[model samples]
Target: MSQYSILAAAVEHRLLEKNSEFITFLQPVSDREQALHWLQHYREHYKDAAHVCWAYIIGNTRQPQTQAFSDDGEPSGTAGKPMLHVLTERELGNCLAVVVRYFGGIKLGAGGLVRAYSAAVSQAAQQARLTLVSPQSLLRIAADFALEARIRQLLAQFDATLLDVQYQQGVALSVSLAAADLASFKLQLQELCAGAVSLTEPTA
Candidate 1:
C-alpha cells in the first residue's frame, strides 16, 4: 500500500474494571528500540503497579516489519494478544501501547482480563487522533544541462521533492517521491528525455 494510518502523537487513557486501574498509553514508535525505550520508561515510572504489559507494531500494521507483545505475568493471550488485536484491527502502524494495571485486591479471570486489556487500548485508540503515512522513495538522476528545467518541471508533475542538485557531471539531481510513483516517474522521465537520462537509487 502507498499509505497507512499511524498515531498522530502520544495519548493516554485510564480505565477502571472491578476496582482495578488500567492506564493505557498509546504512542508513536518508529522502531523496536523506540518501543522498548517507551516500555522501559513505563515500567520504571509505574514500578508499584501490579502488571505493565505492552504491544508494538512497526512499519505497516497489516504486514508489519516487526511486532511483539508481552503478557507481563498475565495469563497467556489475555493481556498482550488482545491488546495487539486492537491495534491491528484499527490499522495503526508504528505505534506502541502499554497498559499499567494496579491490582485492587480483586482477581479477574482470564476472560475478564482479556476484555479489560482490549477495552483499555480500544478506548485509547478511539479517542486518539490518527495521521496518514505515505511511504517515500529516494532517487538520483543524471541528465544533460539542457534538460535541467524539464527535469525540475517533471518533479512537480509527480509531486516529487528535490533534495539536491549538482552542477558537475551535467546536472545530477537527488529527489524523493512517493514510492507508488517511482515506476511511472522513471518511465515518464525517460520518455521526456528521449531515453538520454540515467537514474539510480542510493544505497540504503
Candidate 2:
C-alpha cells in the first residue's frame, strides 16, 4: 500500500448547459461497496432525473485496484469516461464522482455531453476537501511492567496508534504504524529496553 489522497468529505456542485441541469456529487469512499451505496442513494433520491453518471477509483490512484464507471443513458464514451479521466488526472483515490442530469428539452451532442460531464466533475473536485492517507501495519510488543510507561512514550514518539494493552504476566501492547516507520520504531524500542522487549506478530 502507498500514500494517496481521498475526499475528506462530500461536496456538491451544479452547472447549467443549454438549460440542462447538471448536479455533481463528490464523496470519499473506502471500497466499491461504499461507492455503490452512494450511487444507489443518489439514484433513489433523484429518481426523476434524466441520467445518473458515475465513476469510482479505489486504492492507489496511479494504478487503481478497482475502478468502474457508468454513463447511464448517455452516449458511449461521453459521460462516465470523461468524468473518470478527470479523477485519474487529478490523482485521487478512494473516491467517487457522480453527475445527475435533469433534461431541459435540449440534446447535447456526444462531444458536448463529454465536456459538460467532465467540467461538472472538475469543478466539484476543485471545491472538495481532501486528505492524504498513508498505509499502516499492525505490530505487537511485550515488555516488563516496569518498562510499560517508557514503551508508551516510544509509541507516541513514533506516531504509532495504540490498539490494545494487556496486563497479564507483563505489559503486552498492540499498535499500528506506517510501514515506513516500522524499522526505526523497532530499533528505538530495542535500545530503550536494552533488548528486554520482545516483538511478535500482530495479534489482530
Candidate 3:
C-alpha cells in the first residue's frame, strides 16, 4: 500500500462569469481547532466575498474520524455539501477545502451553488500537487572511528534519509530506507561492515 502527503498551503484561481477568486487547501490537520483556525484566517482574508463555506476530513484509517461542513449562511445543501463531495471523491484524508465565493450579483440557486463550490475546489486541487509517501524502516547505527568511512560510502549509493546523527564515545547515525528496499540496504551494510555493524529498527 502507498500513502500520499497533503499539499502545502497555496492559492489557485477559479473564475466564473465576471467574478474570480482563489481557493486554497492544505492538510495533515486532524482537529477542529486547526480547521477553525484556517476557516477564521480564510474568512478574514476573503472578507469581501459573499460566502466562505468549507468542509474538512480528519483522522486516518486507524483513528476516530470527523467530517464537517458549513454553508456560511447559504441555502442548506448548496455550498458545503458539494465541497465535501469533492474531498470524498478524491479520497483525501486529514484535509480541508475552503471556497471563497465572490457573488457575481447573480443568484445561483441550489444547483448552481453546488457546481460552483465543487469546481472551485477541483481547480485548487489540480494546482496543489501531491507526493507519494510510504512507510520506511529507520535504522540506528553506533560505530567506532574505523567504521565511519566505509558506512558513509555504502549509504551514499542509496537514497537514504538521514534522520539524525549524534556523537559521543562513538558516532551514532540514524537513517531511514524505504521498507521495500530494506533487504538490499541490509545486504550492503553488512558487506561494508564485514558483519561487524549492528543495525536495529527504530520506532515508527
Candidate 4:
C-alpha cells in the first residue's frame, strides 16, 4: 500500500445544530469488517439516537479500494455523504466515521445537517493524531552473533522493525521496514556486515 494517513486513536466530536446533537466518532480500522464492527458498537450503544450515520474508506484515500456511507434516516445526502466528504477531503483512509444524532427538537434542514456533520468530523480530526502509514516489506537476514549489535543499530537507523530472531551457528532475523528504505538499508547493512551477512525475503 502507498503511504497514507489513518487516525492514531478513536476521536469524538460534538456539534449542536438547532436542537440536534451530532456526536461523531472516528476510528482506525483495517477493513470493511472492522469498520462495520465499530459502527455496530456505536449503534448498540446509542439505541435512542435518531440516526447512526456512518462512512468508511478502506485503502489508499486518494484512490480508495472501497468507500461507503449511509445517512441512516436523515434526509437523503444530508448526513453520511457530508461526513464522508470531510474524511476524503482530509485524505484519511483505513478509518471509520460514525455520527450519532440525538434529536434536540428542531430539525436542521438538509444544508444545516450537511454543515453540522462535516464540521463535527473536521473538528474531531483536528484534535486527533493522524499517523502516516507506509507500506512495509519483510526481509530475513543471517549474521554472526558478534555482529548482532551493529545490525540492530542499522535497522534502527533505517526505521526497520525486528520481527523475530532465531539462533543457530549464527543468528537469523526477520525484519520489516518501509519499502522505500530497502535499498539504502541494504547498502548500509552491506557496509556494516561486510561479507558476513545474507539478506533475503522470507519464502512464502
Candidate 5:
C-alpha cells in the first residue's frame, strides 16, 4: 500500500485490574533495531516487574519481514499474542507495544491475562495520535543550470521535498517524493527538459 497509519508519538497507559498493575508503552518504530531498543529499554527500566511482554510489527504491513512477540513469564498465547492482535486489528504498522505487569498477589487466569494485556494495549492505542504516512523514495536528478528553476517549480508542483542540491558541471538535485508519484514525475521531467535531464532510479 502507498499509505499506512503510524503512531504520531510515543504514548503510555496504565491499568489496574484485580490488584495487578499493567503498564502499556506504545511507540512508532521504523525498523527492527528501533523496536528492539525500546523493548530493551523498558525491560531494564522495569526489571522488577512480574512480566514484561512485548510485540512489534516492523517493515511494510502487507508483507512484514520482522514481526515477533514474547509472552515473558506469562502463559504462552496469553500476553504477547493478544497484544499483537490488538495492534494488527488496528492495522498499525511500524510500531511496538510493550506491557509491563506487576503481580498483585492474586493470579489472573489465562483468559483474564489475555484480556488484561489486550485491554492495556487497546487503551494505549486509543489515546495515541496516529498519522498517515505515504511511502517515499529518494530521486536524484541531474540537469543543466538553465533548467534549475523549472526543476524546482516542477518539484513543488509534485509535492516533492528537496533534500540536497549540488552545483557541479550541472545541477544535481536530490529529492524525496511519494513512491506512487515516481513514474509521473519522471515523465514530467523528461517532457520539461526535452529529455536533457537525467533521472536516476529511486532509492528507498
Candidate 6:
C-alpha cells in the first residue's frame, strides 16, 4: 500500500461575524513543527481576534491522539474540542482547526460554543475538499548502450519518471515508477532489454 501525509493547505476558509467569530480549518498536516508553523502564520493574520482556539490530531489513522482546544476565555470545551471533533468525524488526518473568536459580546454557553465551533470546522472542511495521495518508488535500470533506445521506448508506455542517464557508467538509466507498478515494470524492462538490463527498486 502507498503511504501519504495530508497538509493544511489542502483545506482552508474563514468565517467572520462581529458577534460570533471565524472558524478556519487548515489542510492536513503532519508533526508538531508544521502544525505550530501554520498556527503562527494564521495567528498573525487574525491577530486582532479576541481568542484563537485550536485543535489537532497527530498520530496514526487507526489510533489518533486526542485534540487541544481553548475557549480563549470562553467556557472550556466550547470552542476547541468541538472543532477537533469535526475533523475527527470526517476521518481527516494531520489536520488543525483554528477558531478565532471576535467576542460577540453575548456569551454563547458551552453548548452554544460547541455548536458554533463544530459548525465552523465542518463548514470549512466542506468547502475545502478532500484528495487522495499515493507513495511512489523509483526503479533504476542499467542497460547496455545498444539497448537504451528500446528501454526508453518501453518506459514511455507507462507513467514513468526518468531520473538520469550516465553513459560513463555503462549506459546508466534511472527511472521512477509507482511502487504498485514495480512488478509489472520489472517484467517489461526485462523483456525490453532482452535480459541485459539490471533493475533496482528504491522506496520513496
The candidate that wins on lDDT is 1
TM-score per model over all chains: 0.95, 0.89, 0.66, 0.78, 0.91, 0.69
Ranking by TM-score: 1, 5, 2, 4, 6, 3
| Ranking of all predicted structures according to lDDT, beginning with the best and ending with the worst | 1, 2, 5, 4, 3, 6
Candidate RMSDs in Å, in order, are 1.3, 2.1, 4.6, 3.1, 1.8, 4.4
- 3 or 4: which has the higher lDDT? 4
Candidate 4, residues 3-23: lDDT per residue as tens digits? Answer: 888777888889887888889
Q: Write the per-residue lDDT of candidate 3 for residues 79-193, one digit (tens) a residue.
A: 7888877777665556778877776666777887777778877777766655455557889887876898877776777787878878888878899877778889888888777
Q: Could you tell me which residue pairs clash in candidate 6?
A: 6-28, 7-27, 7-28, 8-27, 15-22, 19-104, 29-94
lDDT of 5 at 195: 97
* Pick by lDDT: 2 or 3, better one: 2
Candidate 2, lDDT over the whole model: 0.91
**What lDDT, from 0 to 1, does candidate 6 have?**
0.72
Candidate 1 lDDT score at position 77: 92
Where is model 6 more than 4 Å wrong at Cα? 2-18, 25-35, 55-85, 88-96, 109-111, 129-131
Superposed model 1: Cα runs more than 4 Å off = none
lDDT of each: 0.94, 0.91, 0.73, 0.88, 0.90, 0.72
Q: What lDDT tens digits, residue by residue, belong to model 6 across residues 1-204? A: 554344435666666543776757575677767777878887898888888888887643336644455566767777777777777777566777777777778777777777877887888877665554444678788877888888888778877888988887578877876667778888988877779888876554
Question: What are the per-residue Cα lDDT tens digits for candidate 5 across 19-68?
Answer: 99999999899888999999999999999999999999975655675888
Count of clashes in candidate 6: 7
Best by TM-score: 1
- lDDT (Cα, tens digit) per residue for candidate 1, span 37-147: 999999999999999999999988888999999999999999999999999999879899999999988999999999999999999999888888788899999999999
* lDDT string, candidate 2, 131-172, tens digits: 888878789999899999999999889889998999999999
Weakest lDDT window of 10 consecutive positions for candidate 6? 1-10
Each model's total of backbone clashes: 0, 0, 0, 1, 0, 7
lDDT for model 1, on a 0 to 1 scale? 0.94
Badly placed stretches (over 4 Å) of model 2 are 63-65, 201-204
Pitting candidate 4 against candidate 6, the one with the higher TM-score is 4
